[model samples]
Target: MSPPTITENFVDFDIPQAGKPCKTWYTIYGDLGTSKYPPLVVLHGGPGMPCNYLKPYGQLASKSLIPVVLYDSIGCGNSTLLPEKRGDGTFFNIDLHMNELDNLLKGLGIEDEFNLLGHSYGALLGAWYAATRKPQGLRRLILQSGPASLPLWDEAQMDLRYQLPKELQDILDQHEASNTTDSPEYKEVVAEFTRRHVCRIEPAPKELQETFDAAARDPTVVLTMYGDHEFETNGTLRGWSSINELDKINIPTLIMNGRYDTAQDKVMKPFFDRIPRVRWIQFSESSHTAHLEIERERVMEVVIEFLTEDV
Candidate 1:
């Protein structure tokens, strides 16, 4: 049977730091009230990237009978965008995101029974949440292209940079050193790097491209949380590392990444080694955003199998 119609709504969230009410925009697919499969809450990557690219996750709802939820985190996408929050290290922290996520769950009334699928930065957020809170309701975790340690992530990226053509590498280095990341030359190299490690598809999927475009337009959140680019570590989250804490995530976990993923296997090794009940898979033909690229079908199948195995 086909899944129920998707529903889009907004939840009023109180951001204490902003001292104003911010509404989080979320979309739900399938029948939340009646589905036997545990709802999967998909957390999109980027400290600022919205959930638009994750819209395809609704396929699980229609095909596998799983409910799916996607939302734009605070200061991003359809949620409130606080440009003023940018460049202020003290304002954006891990806890701020955690609290917002907690509020989203409570508001959606799914705090008691839900699964989490976090990609990239979202993976870090979800992993940190699971490690620290150990929420009783969180049944499973899907970490896709997740970096276990920011330092290791930077290291891997630098290695990838070295592999690039010397001319492109020089452009990246020169621009970054001069704080001229906005230059077209810098963006050209960034795109080249993305093609190699972000998504290998000839043309990025529409939704994925849209997300990239949005991040390019207003990179405040990503800039504040992460850095000028993938290889840089000058942001507030530069020192963030969840490697030592992965052991605390006792729930069944699935870790995925493309062979050419920006979050290289070396960076994600700690997750496989430390998470007690973890399954690791590398997509040989894909990259960071494999869900929308070459391994799309296989990735979804594996995710559904993992989520439904014990159900």
Candidate 2:
């Protein structure tokens, strides 16, 4: 009946490229030191997106007594921002973010025992970390509406784009071909696609909108790591894939996506097919942000169940 205990702080992070000091902002719901369960470290999407939209998931702390950890990836949210790093692909690559996550874990003193739940781009990062780092303490993995690889992700988006109305399809093609994705026309068409596949909820939740606004205000991370186009990749992550390394992810895994997600079943299938231990669930009535938009309660139930069940 009472509000969950919340703690906010900054972890000093040193970035070699910046040649200066940096910090990662993090918040914890529930008492990590006192809780019996390992903390659930949440990774948000957007390679650049802040952690605002994912804040709802903090309920696990209050509801189930599981500590929930949320932090803005460096260059996003309350963490250090690098507007000057815009278009600097060499500096904004995945490894930088991964290292930041690693630092946060050690700084929080839970790197040894923790669960991971990643959404969209965050999912991709989670998969990579589990597969490559093979952290011995990682207990469970949740990949929420995330693709296994960028190429497969882009392919699925192209397939979805073709299914759109011809008029809208033509508009996207014309704008993309002209490299005018910044145009209002292109953005409008993109918004149409986003409404259908990204977040079907009319007038998205305030937290979701905050993430979008943060990305728009400083798109350095998305623009440099992902790219301007929604359906394609022209940035540093062009051919990224973790298919071969998936088998290394020895922990129990749960993969989820909406029926209408841009991360179509095809893109998520590789994770299910390759991971040694995994479960897949698709929300029939949801899109990309199933947890925040339409199926919040169900999503929480499924995640909580997975996190608590003895394996």
Best by lDDT: 2
TM per model?
Answer: 0.96, 0.97
Give the Cα-based TM-score of candidate 1 against the true structure: 0.96
Q: What stretches of model 2 exceed 4 Å from their correct place?
A: none
Tens-place lDDT per residue, model 2, 101-187, is: 889999999988999999999999999999998888899999998879999999999999999999999998898788887899988
Off by over 4 Å in 1: 1-4
Best by TM-score: 2
Candidate 1: give its CA RMSD in angstroms. 1.4
lDDT of the structure predicted as candidate 1: 0.88
Residue 215 of candidate 2: its Cα lDDT? 86
Error of 1 at 36 (Å): 0.5
What is the C-alpha local distance difference test score of each model? 0.88, 0.90
Query: What TM-score does prediction 2 earn?
Result: 0.97
Residue-wise C-alpha lDDT for candidate 1, range 1-311, written one tens digit per residue: 65557999998888778877789889999878888988999988888998888888889998798999999888888888888889887877788888888888999999999999999998988899999989999999999998898889899999999999999988987987899988998988888998999988878888988888888778888889887665867889897899888899999999999999889998889999999999998999998988888779999999999999969
